[model samples]
Target: MNIFEFIRDPSQIGPWFHQLLLSAGMQEWVANLIGDVIGVLLIVGAVLTSAIFLIWLERKIAARLQDRVGPNRAGPYGLLQTLADIVKLLTKEDVTPDGADRVSFNLAPALMVMQIIMVAAIIPISAGLIGANLSVGLLYFIAMSGIASIGALMAGWASNNKYALLGGFRVVAQLLSYEIPLAFSLLAAVIWTGTMATNNLAMQQGELLFGFIPGWNILVMPFAALIFFIATLAEGERAPFDLLEAESEIVAGPNIEYSGLKFAWFYLQFFVNSLLLACIFTTVFLGGWQGPFVDQFPLLGIVYFFVKSLLVLLALMWVRATYPRLRIDQMMTFCWKVLVPVTLVVVLIVAIGARITPDRSINAVIISGANIVALLVTLGIIGRSLRRDVQRRKAALPGRSTAQV
Candidate 1:
């Protein structure tokens, strides 16, 4: 393809590069290997570059929410602040604690970053544009994504600090607890679409529902979307659910002992993972790469995908800025008691709805209606429970009367 054609259909860039290598008299296997390496490099580069930008973006977002200026002195509107931080981190002395396990202490941060890259590999950026379009992409993502918890454990345990170890324990608890609802939420989407491939999930969402609304999973499975988003906030260790790194309690969490570039890896992984999860959420629910006229101009898909992902990321930032951190008990209780049960019900309802109809639009409408009713019921139950707790607290007060309570 020529430049203009490639511009219109960026998805073909991979194949085009492969062909270009072939035209240079390279062997087929060699060309394929080179192409794959280049693809991996590109994915890594994109992720790392985005992490730098997101760091600044998040700081600015938080500053705006808090009514303050953030990173203004480093560069124009603080655009260069993250770059300066990167330089400082690189120049800092690399210090592995005197009693630390050298191997695992060094390995943990790289592993943390590696897992995020692995999950990103299967994500479809646009039509036919993915590093590895595995058939069981969703399952692969889930398996690979869990490696972060292992990394956190490694960091905490290998550091030999009590607080770090506690942070590790919290990571295990928080990630494992939320993974259930996260998996169930994705299961709802799988049941509705009858596929677990990430690309297929996005492709299925390309059509228009009833010839008007975008056929995004979020529209039909709002409960699943809500559950998935909430579980994701906990999984990513954003505020409120950020018990893993509750600096107030655990100092700096799993990577507390890390310094210099070692610390930067964990720091980079935080922002990168948040963005990746938002991308995954967009792919599964918000219709990744599906936009108007995208068929005619495939490059627009990338724009649509990133715009949706950014909005999700911004929502995450807003939550981080707005809410106070939850107590460990409260976090766990919300997950096991609230998110898990609600997600299960959402999955069952979706399964029934999908099985009841062959037409997607019909199924969507039915499922959407069912989701609304389920939401109302869930809210009513939660409200009633909260009222009872308040009443009980009032009754237990020494000088409280029924009227005052």
Candidate 2:
């Protein structure tokens, strides 16, 4: 089937395995079981496909940003580069350090891979297309995301390398620092919509304010949206917040001992989290699977969802190209001292605004205004604090002026 047909009728589009099972006149239960297995396989295939595309895209974007040519060989603009890398990794040796804990070292990568795959289950491509629709879907997604931190720690401890162990500790600190603001920012959105189900959140974003402007939660809570995106940047270990594996400083950090496929697993998890971040951002803030005429042609939702997600993904790539990595101290300080307090105030503002206001449209706008105000206020306070610190330090230095210092 073509892309249009597949988008319009996902269940009807077959990979032949499920089709063969159904065509054999299998019982309903058996057919469903086989189909589900195929669905999982298909999802895995999709992740691999996306990884291949995104890997190439990242290098191209980075090259462009750095003013150089990217891959022009290997099948038209280096589309086959990722494929070649995969083959190389799969064919290479798998080495284990003698001091490494064999069981934990082997199991850590698999555990992280499992958690990454689990996230795909709740990512909605369209209204009717999802692996499962739990009532607490958003909550579940948040909880499951943190489990991979354990795998990170395990990878570090199991390696018996000092750098790996420090990397593991850094992962724990980074995850804990970011996850709090991420959760509260999400709560601010939930406070406005009053549901933890991702689908319901999507539905809430479906309305339009002036018939053309989308009623996206981002419009109502831009601060939360910004905070959520930043937190996810840290969570995904992207640039600027990716101190966990600062090559110059730590020599590859937690995965230093992992060779071949095990290292590939670590690499895969980064892009997976990136993809999932874009999807969740679409669902919560960009109106998931929502666009013009989607009501009339519901299948168009898949197109809309992908388009939105790609735009977000591109923005992330741009950020990676533009920003330099933060100091570990700065990364943690920004999360705890800035994001946490700001998100808490935003949540409180949302809660109060929702309670006193009768109309959702009016309340949403008011809450948005309040969030912006709070953001500005927080920035002002931070600026003042930084200036004060600078002044005190300059005073302590007898020979240094502020500019010279």
Per-model lDDT: 0.91, 0.85
lDDT (tens digit, per residue) of candidate 1 on 54-143: 999999999999898888988899999999999999999998887999999988999999998898898888888888878898888788
Each model's TM-score?
A: 0.97, 0.93
Candidate 1: minimum summed lDDT over ten consecutive residues — where?
396-405
Task: Please provide, for model 2 over 1-405, each residue's C-alpha lDDT reduced to its tens digit, 9 standing for 90 to 100.
Answer: 467766555634544446667779997679888778877987878875687788888889888988988987888988898999999999999999998999999999998888778888777787757776678888887888778899999999999999999998999899988999989988888887788887778877888865667889889889889999998898888889889899988888799999999999988888877888899989988889878887766787889999999888888888888899999999988988898888888889989988776777788778888888988888899999999989888989979767876
Of the candidates shown, which would achieve the greatest lDDT relative to the real structure?
1
| Highest-scoring model, TM-score | 1
lDDT of 2: 0.85
The residue-level lDDT of candidate 1 at 366 comes to 96
* lDDT for residue 149 in candidate 2, whole number 0-100: 90
